[model samples]
Target chain A: MMNPKGTQPEDLVWECQACHVNLVEGPVTLMYMGNRITVDLPQCPRCGFVLVSEAVALGKMAEVEQALEDK
Target chain B: MTAFTARALSHVPHVLRGITGNTLRPGGLALTERAADWCAFQPGARVLDIGCGLGATLMYLRDIRGCRACGLAISAQMLSECRGMPVLQAAGDILPFYDKCLDGIFCECVVSLLVEPPKAFREFCRVLRPAGWLVLTDVYLRNPQSGAGDLAASATCLSGASDNTELMKHLNDCGFDVILWEDHSRYLTELAARMVWTLGSRELLMQLLFPGGCSAENKQNMQGASPGYGLWIARLKGPKR
Candidate 1:
């Protein structure tokens, strides 16, 4: 199957260590401050282990925290 | 910064209702439920929802809460979406009702958008029965001294926010005594963050939501404004004195 639009893997790919399989792009739901927001991220299809990339961690995650703090 | 066209931000609820859980404002109907619970509105109570974007609260009030709720919206486009719901097209400052007719008014996320807040307060006072409750959820200016004139021409709620002292005075002068004040700033911040994440950046979110225009500088101007959200529950004492 082809990756969905805008779900291309980042420069650094991640493999699930336990499942011994490469991560595939899929939907992930993030819960924060009693709210749930869904986004696309890399995860192991076999074991469903998600990978949080450095770019996403520092980029959108930072934005979410900045939004939550309000300070 | 590119300027927002007239009433651009005010139209946010209509454009983004799909992603915002079919409600026009932050915290959606969850905030509405909280406010109604706080007011202890009985079944069959007559309530008005000012700025009722798509009349989600109207359905909730009538079907779930068992209240005789009517909604008012300044935008005809907003009212057009309310199929088979009890709602009206009108401004908050000029409500269409006899004196002391309503049991409560849900002015959620709308007070700060009023062009003439004092006038709207008087209208809220005039339309409510004695001790009739008002539930207000709105964005507020966090830093009163800074960004004083930056949003002079913007149509967002940030343009109309005032310091707490001034806000309380407005309520008092309109014969309302506040029964509860709760800080819900997280809701506003969370919504902003979600928009930023979904749209890639705050600028992009602004551009999409307000098609007129937005620039990087407007983002800075917004940060300078330091917006916050709050919920206020008050009861009308009598006619404005």
Candidate 2:
């Protein structure tokens, strides 16, 4: 799959910040404004730590919260 | 025949295709072909195209793949254009078919517009035979917050879109096993671009439709809020106990 920016898959790199291990993309549940949203993101394989990049956090997740609040 | 054709032509302006392009759904017939190829339907497979707007996909399936394809649309006006095809005027949540009757279903960009998607999914499960395939494509929210403060957006299928996780749960809850899930957000973006070009301005169309409901700033703010589109190929599990 291409990266969020539409670049080829080879162009992107994913690594966990805390463990410094290569992170595999997987599903992670996020809580925003008391609602739960599950999205796939890079994660730490060993520690089960998921990484939410700034773009996704401020972009998609933020937008989802807004829509839910609108409802 | 002329009156029927004229009525059908009148209905065309009501469809999104009037503002965008033919085949109101994103990715158009190319995506339909891709979904059909993915389903790999066998000859004489009984397939139903839910929300089969314009009946183009149904015709393609019938003429090209030799499938026994029927269509269902909510609008009687839309059904007028589909006189040559077997079609029924009905909603997706309450299908008029017996259990385990259909071999496959093709629902494109219709689920998001459903008021009760869960009920519709259950209905899909009920109608399909064991191992029956379902080819679904629709927009999904990558970011929900982008749709806030506007009920009209839901009417446009933006607010009703589920994230991937929610979508998976819905399919699983309905006894479907997802065989493939592909992100086709690029096609949606391209369609949006085309709409922007053809309509001259999305803002102009939004204002004409929603008037005071949608504003220029709000439209800009909600731009990336629409996550993307997805294509799912799922199969109905064996009969229930």
Candidate 3:
């Protein structure tokens, strides 16, 4: 129920291009197949645009999605 | 008794205890109620719940459904939690009961985890009355060939999951007539999805299940098995004795 390692592998600070704000790791709720999970991920503080890094998009996120689908 | 569930009880029994305190296993007590309905035991009939963790289902059967229900749990911790309840500490393979003493037996998510399922079923046959019902709900394999043999006990339910054919063979060989077999696989996928979210990832779930991290072979074996949850209501075959 706690936040997992969701940021990209690199420790580089990501700045939102549109909001011109630094993305901070905050609570992000992801839903798939009628199941929801809240985890901390990088997001713009002002606009609340969540940044799901490529590593997370391909790694933990994808893995959980596959497991849910059972494919 | 070398049950995966017993081992898990030693590690993360608290988490499972949380679930069992409410509704253990897939489809929850709704499935239990369904099994009870299908079994159709008369009121005040003596019944036994095998591996009755937390004694929730045992309470339900006795209090709600009006049966004289007692339970047998393998875990000492679980048994300790049921202080005032009519529960006994015993293993499924070696139930300490007289022959033909009970009208029904209810076991959920316990048999497959056993080191020897047929042995326990044989025990069930020996103890159950000729007209007794055996209500079982557990995971089974969709792909008959896809499974881990010796290493099955390493994972959770997937470890002991054999295909429906093998299960049917076990039931038939143990002298039971299959009354019903219904697949409730969506419950498993839904629960797995919820678990994935709650634990953050499949790997975290695996880690929670297998503390200190599981081996590649164990993980691969778990992932390789195509498991499906099922409910079976069977009757011990013989004229009432």
Best by DockQ: 1
The regions of model 3 sitting more than 4 angstroms off are: A1-64, B1-8, B17-20, B149-155, B212-221, B239-241
Residue ranges of candidate 2 with Cα displaced over 4 Å? A1-71, B1-15, B18-22, B145-151, B208-212, B215-221, B239-241
Chain B TM-scores of the candidates? 0.87, 0.86, 0.87
- For candidate 3, write residues B64-140 as lDDT tens digits: 88999999887777777766779987778888899999999998888777777888889899999886899988888
DockQ ranking from best to worst?
A: 1, 3, 2
lDDT by residue for model 2 (B1-241), tens:
1111111112443435753454777777887888788888877999999988778898889999999999987778778888688998777778889998999999888887776677888999999988999988988876766653453443455646666778888999989999999888766655444343334454444543354577556565556465588999999987668
Q: List-wise, what DockQ does each model earn?
A: 0.33, 0.02, 0.26
Taken in order, the candidates have interface RMSDs of: 3.2, 11.4, 3.8
lDDT of 1 by residue, A1-71 (tens): 22666664475567899998989888888877665666778899999999887667877776766655543
The 10 consecutive residues of candidate 1 chain B with the worst lDDT sum are B1-10
* lDDT for each candidate structure: 0.75, 0.71, 0.75
lDDT of 2: 0.71
Q: Given the true complex, what DockQ would model 1 score?
A: 0.33
- Residue A25 in candidate 2, Cα distance off native in Å: 47
- State the local distance difference test value for candidate 3: 0.75
Cα displacement (angstroms), candidate 2, residue B80, comes to 0.3
Model 1, B1-241: lDDT tens digits are 2121123244554335555765767788888899888888889999999888878888899899999999988777778988898888777778878988999999877777765677788989898999999888888877776654545445566667666667878998888999898888767766777776765654465655445554556556666768788888898885446
